[model samples]
Target: MATDYQSAISSTLQRIFGYDRLRPGQEAVISAVVAGRSAAAIFPTGSGKSLCYQLPALLLPHLTLVVSPLLALMQDQLSFLNSRGVAAASIDSAQSREEASAVMAGVRRGEIKVLMISVERLKNERFREFIAQVPISLMVIDEAHCISEWGHNFRPDYLKLPDYQRQFAIPQALLLTATATPQVIADMQTRFAIAADDVIMTGFYRANLNLLIEPVASDDKQHRLVEWLSPRLQEGQEQPSIVYVTQQQSAEQLATMLTHHGLNACAYHAGLPAETRDTIQHQFMAGEVACIVATIAFGMGIDKADIRNVVHFDLPKSVENYSQEIGRAGRDGRPSDCLVLANRDALNVLENFVYGDTPERDGIRRVLEEIAAVQDGSGECRWELMLTALSQHSNIRPLPLKTLLVQLELRGVIAPRFSYFAEYRFKYLRDPEALIAMFEGERQRFVQLIVETSNRARTWCSLDFDALYRRGLESGVNAERSRVVSALEYFNDKGWVVLESKRMTEVYAVTPTPLDIDALSDDLHGYFKSKEESEIARLNAMLALFESDTCLSHRLARYFGDMQAPERCGHCSVCHGHVARLPSPAPLPPLESQSFVELCDQIIERYQAAFEGQVPGVDLLTRYLCGITAPLFTRLKARQSKGFSRLEAYPYAEVRQWVSVHLTGDQ
Candidate 1:
């Protein structure tokens, strides 16, 4: 007679996923998990990383618990699995009260073979309670690099997952990430306490992706982008594309511009209402939107595999971010273009972004002072700056110090972002019959709308609250929307239902509210003074990239430690002889304080008069004064004066920096 184990595994793979063979390193990783060994799988984007763990979960005796980094990812993956007739479910912040209860009930009944959740969700007391009752055979962490401080995206709550793993005694655990350097891989192994032999890494090389970087003048970047895209967009031959911008407003502006140029496009960013984001995402996924211009927030949880091109409208924060963003393209084994619209100014923007966020010398000094006051100075690795910093703050002594430093780098802060998921249990104050009786006329129609929205999903009522409110208002409901919102909150507070919300806390550097030059310590004072001077040099270095005659791809790759071959990639603007080398303009002399102050007052007065008592914020004023074409100002034709363009002669960022220093007394 055939063994039940072999039969079950085969049936699970064929019946559920209809797959005949596992991808490259999947089978070995699955076998290791089956043998109850903890493993880490570092596969490239588009590699079948999910199958490595998902297949093993089917063979395991206990429920497989997957800790995903994003709720959207969990929902999408769960939906896909369920559609394939697999027993999978996810509990996240989006889940409705009844839906969460039903999922919990399923877990209790052993009906859910695989349960997906976000790391933030694992921190909840109730979720912890639920986990305690379930026998988890395998614990899988998606985007496991977040656990490593050295990883591009460092999530603080990810540090807490090991405790959960230990508490659950998860027989086997798996860590998965699309992008991890060799250092990051080791960091994951050390953090998870996984054996060296169990760590599996598929190489990061993706031959289908043609990484091309185009260098242009910052002022001409938009024109260059339009020229480059005009042909392909007009032809409409390629698969859907995504344009990633550094800012939310840039995404919106670019999307609008692209649409005006006759391309189907939409903007996606976190600042938009969740319903709007969901609608845009769905439309993009359904091919209703041909291109989505978005910030980093847009693509984290997206799994659409046919993205033909990924364009960077602005440079990413780091080389790792650049790699990961580009990885999103060519997922379908098709030739895909990964383009970066680089310029000297873009690099300055990235550098300034880094310097602006990173703790200054005084802030660092304060943290050191705190450490010295509290902890004993053993002085094991005084030369190791990052390790010493981590040792002073976090309690995890054996954790990878470099990883922590990387986290600090990604966060650009002394302390990582504080994050936790909140669980709210709801209790209905009235019986179902009484609740129904409470509604009449417009209220009845509003109640009906809520019921109709709730019917969208069997287990989760992922209703768009804003859309529901709008519908209620359109139905002539005189009732205040706040009452409905309060009722929902009351239900959650009363334990009639549970709602989970992920809260992320950001900590600013501990320093004087306004930086006082006069009060600075001698050494600390010198550092800031030097930093101001050094920024000009840094700006020059950025400009150098634009003027460099080398292949743009090779130059970027070299910056990220990739050794260059002799020949240049013939596809870039540099190689194509389209790049025009220009001499650096003479730097402006530092403005006298009295003159600068007078100029600021004049600009402010002009802005107030122009807008008729409605002056824009400091950022907008700075942009306007510096001759930057802000989308809103451009659309309104507000910056048409000669004075505006003349201001470009000065370093706009430096001017802004000075204005901030003088006004807020903070740098």
Candidate 2:
């Protein structure tokens, strides 16, 4: 049987992927699947992890269910599998109702050997019904770190998989990821209910990939990127590359700049229309676009193999994100470069980003004061912190707290930013033909405007209602706006168009519905305070990663719990030059002259009219006054100017601290 399996694997490799033999761990992972044993494979990025499960799904009689995190990844994998003559399908939000139903039917009938889906889809009652009827042989969770709160990318829905595992009674399962620290691994095992002996970890080392971090002044960083990239892209040797930025506008701007500099580049981010993103991704994969300038939203589930470089145009929020982003390089075993252009200003920008998004003390206190009344206060770990925070608003746990915490830490949010979904709706009056025919007066013009505004393309359209309403007012149709809106609403009710609205709410920590308000409140408060401290600690740790003169790889490895030699890699910027230190300033004596309330009132009045009477929380107001362009404040036109001209002389940190104390009544 083993010999037969090896022969099948070899034949599949040659016939399907045009490879001669399996990589190091592929055979073992395949063998475990063939034997019907649960297994976890921790291979480094670009190590051909997908083939481990894909090949077995082809050989086995049972259908394979692959739970993926991103819709783009699901589509890419399905496309690749179908191209290779394998029967595979994916169901995601992108799929039409008919398509999804057909896929479900195929799974139940054993016609589809592999079905790819997101974890959230599994929670759907209809999908659950179909899953119960299918004879699934293998269950795979790609990006398995999402199951752990400690993992850098946590998805709360992943925590619910164990229940599905029990329901399906799946004898074999595979949890695969390119990155996982020891804590993450342990958390995955606990969450997935995997046996300790089933875990297979390959050490994190990619000798062919040279990791380099260059600390330059903010303005010079772009110049260094251009210089490094130009040498690599000489006339006959343009390699596939990805340059990650934190902002969507930056992605577009950088892509345009790079294209002007003679690089074939395009921008990729979620902010663009879906079709545009799809076109750009396809072009990049086909080598039509030599480089892609993207926000962090661009690369989940991407399977492109010959990528030669991964450059960070802006610092990522966490070391895990940095590792994951850079891991996209050198997957084809060729020498690839991972470059990060860091500076003191970037650090400050990141810190301000963190401070700004953290829920204000009042919000934090509201939830914490409630949690402080709970009994689970002493026994709770970091995961409990997430659960309590989410439980404050809703009965259902919308997101896994553990995963959210990791994401917040990576994004430099001192606390979890409230998560919200976007919803939209459109309506039309009269029969479809009548509406098209009724364009005889202003009614006709309004109808034309609605059609033009809502007609996104052939299949679907997204109307920016705000923009449309403004256009209506500009055109002197302020009173007619109501009739137009009413028509759209009517069409939405008739199912001719979509009506959508999204709200952000807390994900509850418990499932059975808590009856003890006091206990829940106590637990919530304790978790909030603990998370606040943990976030601060994580930020300091990231700072230390930059400050160390040691090997970047070694520092990264140590952070992930690999106790290896600390010898300098000699490839990073720190090893090549002296590590720069931050300047220490003298501490100021306590301010005794002005009371907290008196000072806050003075500052509020000074900036009240400018800020529209509602002062943004302390940290935000401070960043604005200090002339810093933090992410949140940077979006507003009003905050950009030196409006707080009188307050410019005072230190921002002091003002922020003073305002915070007054707002919380701690002063």
Candidate 3:
């Protein structure tokens, strides 16, 4: 260990970042990374997790690769590092071919010490092939909790990161996340083969945020949201706020309602185009927008510290989600409000999302059979071919299919070659002949050769990089694909084309063994069912936090592995007597009443009626009436139907109760 390590960190913290000193837990994590050891740091939101990796990235001799889940997070961290004068660049789809090429060039030339990339890039065979040639000193996994099944936000892709580590032989790895329970912590350490002593956690307690939960009636949630937000919209009190919702439709409706009430508000979800979401986030961060009514997608990479309020208009899906979202507020160390309008009815809606993800045993069987059919005698199957065939043959969705794929990989029934390139598409911006004229002699010959190899003459065509490389071989150029990509990037920079590409999503080859397809498929179904149950339990834990009698912060701290939390923080809803006592709504208009049975019959009839050769199930109908989407409904093209959200304005509980009794017979 260098005795000057502390001095180095302190001087860098003060000189480069203008910080007084390293924040709590940062120095230790950074030390571990510097010493080529693995560590997991579970710092709370507003605490600087990036510094743990950023400082070491500078001191380390080789490039540090940061694998992040969200595009916004990568871009934001890249911008922050550049602002601090650190040479950082990210490989994101939003970047132009020229921009991505510039990043790749910088990494190869050692001009970029820190590189940020989405985990999805690992799915790109070409990228993985490219990374194999690079010398990487450190691997940083942000939002590391996503690796564990016990985590609130379990991303299947993060589970593959451990393999990437061994592939690159990355000596030093660090797992950075804001929220992780004790279970998630244990899982990360086990999966990454990390040491138990390497886990570093900071406190989750935030004194500046006043946590409040209002137990409003489902019908009154809208009014309560308005009541809380209207005052903030007043002159001189134009503090930015985020009202979290559960559904894309609700986000739009709520934002529209807010705007009609004279508030500058907008809705955000993945359903909106990427450009629109980016614009909304920018406006919100710039203070041009007062409020953003968003779903979970809106908060991940947003670093706005002065947000004065965070309100959960619908129930949050997990204790981790609640804590992380509310943590967005008061980041500037100023007092801010954290409010949740808890309604029991919202639980059914939240739980339905969990149920929607669990695929049937038959669906898992179909997926396995498809893969088996595609597998050659060598037990290898093209990942893209299988996925495409399965998608075309059945209505099984990506989420459930991904879970099954992960289950198969975990079971040793199949293995994923995560580095395979899937497909790449591009659109020409200028005339093809004119663009081709820019190249002459060898350049012109090679460009034409690559284009002829691609075989996609029209707009939105896929290119075979491997085939193109083969053509390059015939042209006596060893760096053929790189040259083609570089030329494409050059054209893009010159406004001749807009290029886009995606790596294949996890291709796997079947393992040779005594086969038990039935048993394996059943087990996969259980695996996904367990995931659903885990998510439901997480959601309940969030509600449990709201319902706790102790101080809200204390409960939150204890939930995130802080058993020593004080009984009284004196800043929560419980401490202030804002228990949010609720009055019961009128009984569900009598189960057999005209208002009840007709709505119930309508719900049953709408789902029982098939569309696109797929029948909607109880779970799908439940989500439909509850105003949420089940995975298959949209894929089956039923969402465009006239009655998809007939009961959208009603309480989820009311509709769910009637369906359970009348249609499902209470299961």
Candidate 4:
């Protein structure tokens, strides 16, 4: 039996993937997964983490459902799978309804062995219902570190994956990540019910990556980067590099700077159109573009193996980010330069990001009140909120709002149900009579009635499913909303109409616990405070790593739970005796100055309505002035005002103090 298993693995590995052997930790992870045990694979980036699940996916029965974080990641995986003649499909919002419908049908028929989707896809009510009926053998979560609230890239949606597994009755889970600290590893193990012994963690040290840190004045940093990049962009090497920045605007400006210096460079960020981002990525991969200036959004699932340089124009938000970003280079067992242009200027902006995400206590209470008010007829609540609308209404950003909701769920206040589109619009391709004629008898009459009742516009028809459901009950016909939606989807599948959905609202089942809104609000606020402190501490830790006299590579490896890494890598900045304190830029004008105070007064009076009917408190005003945009801030065009980011260079705490002392008179 042992020989047969070995032979099967070798033959499958060679025949399907054309690989001779698994990378370190991949075989063990695959073994655990194939044995029907949950396992975590903690490998560094570009270390073949995908193979841990990809290989097992082929051997698993029924299906392997992979929850990836980015569409680019899914597309890359799908392209690889398709090239290998493996049955794989992805259903994403970018796909037309016909395309998504086809993928669903293939899943239902058990024709697609591997399915990739974003975690947000699991929130779809229809998709959830469809998946519940399918038999899933394994569930793979790429970048699984996002599941932990303590992780640097904590996403609230990822917290629901375990529940989703139970809902889908998936028997085993394979959690994968390129960067997970000891804390994040433990969190993944606990959440996924994986045994500690089953977790396979390869050490984080990559000898081929030569780490370097440069400290310079803010004004001279651009010239220094150009000097660093020009050498690499020479005719022979034309080395591909990625310049990581903190903001979209920074990406654009820096890319323009690089291009002006006569180097091939382009900016990539979420702010850019999807097609443009894709084009830039493709150009980079094809070696047409020598450098990519991007925010964190650019490199989640890119699999370029020969990237020669990874430079940080600004300090990465955390150590994990720095590790992952640098790991992108030196993947092909060749020496690659990983340089960081470190300084204190970007610290204020980074810290403000932390503070901005920490929602106010009053805002938290208001959200709770809103949730509590959404009770049903039996005093039980299945609260379904359009998150964007709720965010704007409560003056909380969507991300922090999601965190609050997740915290409430953890406290047993509510459990996530499913999300659904609030409206469905369709346009008929053929005549309504022709569509009805395709059906017969009762079905035909039902289709005719549906066409007749739909509200028609210029070229599209809208269906009010709620009204139809009520009218169906009145007429003594079983016209469930789901049934009607399925009908519309069927028409779409048949090319009878083009169906479009809009306004996805997430539903939660609220528990009938005793009323304690005040306690809950306080508890949630404390959670956010703790998270904020932890994030700031993470930033400080990264700073310490750069500022210390230790080997840069050794310090990074140790931070990611690699204790056995050598004392000196001999390739990093410290080993080469190149180190300096990162200097801060010149200070801004005092907050108490007459000009600044007058500007603040004008801002408060002019943008009062941007507060969304709430009294402009110190916290909200500080966030607004610091350019940390909240939902209401953007919805009311406050971000467009000149005063929005006027104080962005100052510390958030100082701004808040000034606001309290002068505007609110709280001090």
> lDDT of all the models against the reference?
0.64, 0.66, 0.77, 0.86
True lDDT of residue 385, candidate 4: 89
Q: For candidate 4, lDDT tens digit of each residue in 526-558? A: 989999998999999999999979888888998
User: Which ranges in model 4 have alpha carbons more than 4 Å from their true place?
Assistant: 1-7, 95-111, 166-169, 376-379, 432-440, 464-484, 493-495, 594-597, 606-614, 640-642, 663-667
| Model 4: lDDT to the true structure | 0.86
Candidate 2: tens digits of C-alpha lDDT, residues 265-384: 789998999889989888988888888989998777777778888998787777778878888888777888887766545454455544433343444344443434443444421222
TM-score of each: 0.64, 0.70, 0.83, 0.92
Off by over 4 Å in 3: 271-276, 379-383, 386-389, 416-507, 512-514, 580-586, 589-667
Q: What ranges in model 2 sit over 4 Å off?
A: 1-18, 59-61, 235-237, 256-265, 352-514, 528-539, 561-656, 664-667
Residues forming the 10-long window of minimal summed lDDT in candidate 3: 591-600
Report the C-alpha lDDT of model 1 over 498-614, residue by residue, as the tens digit: 443433222222222222323433444354345445444534544454456776556645443335333476655577775635433345566543254545555566557765876
Please identify model 1 stretches exceeding 4 Å from their true place.
1-11, 235-239, 356-667
Write down the RMSD of candidate 2 (Cα, Å). Answer: 10.3
Q: What's model 1's overall lDDT?
A: 0.64
What is the TM-score of candidate 1?
0.64
Error of 3 at 244 (Å): 1.7
lDDT leader: 4
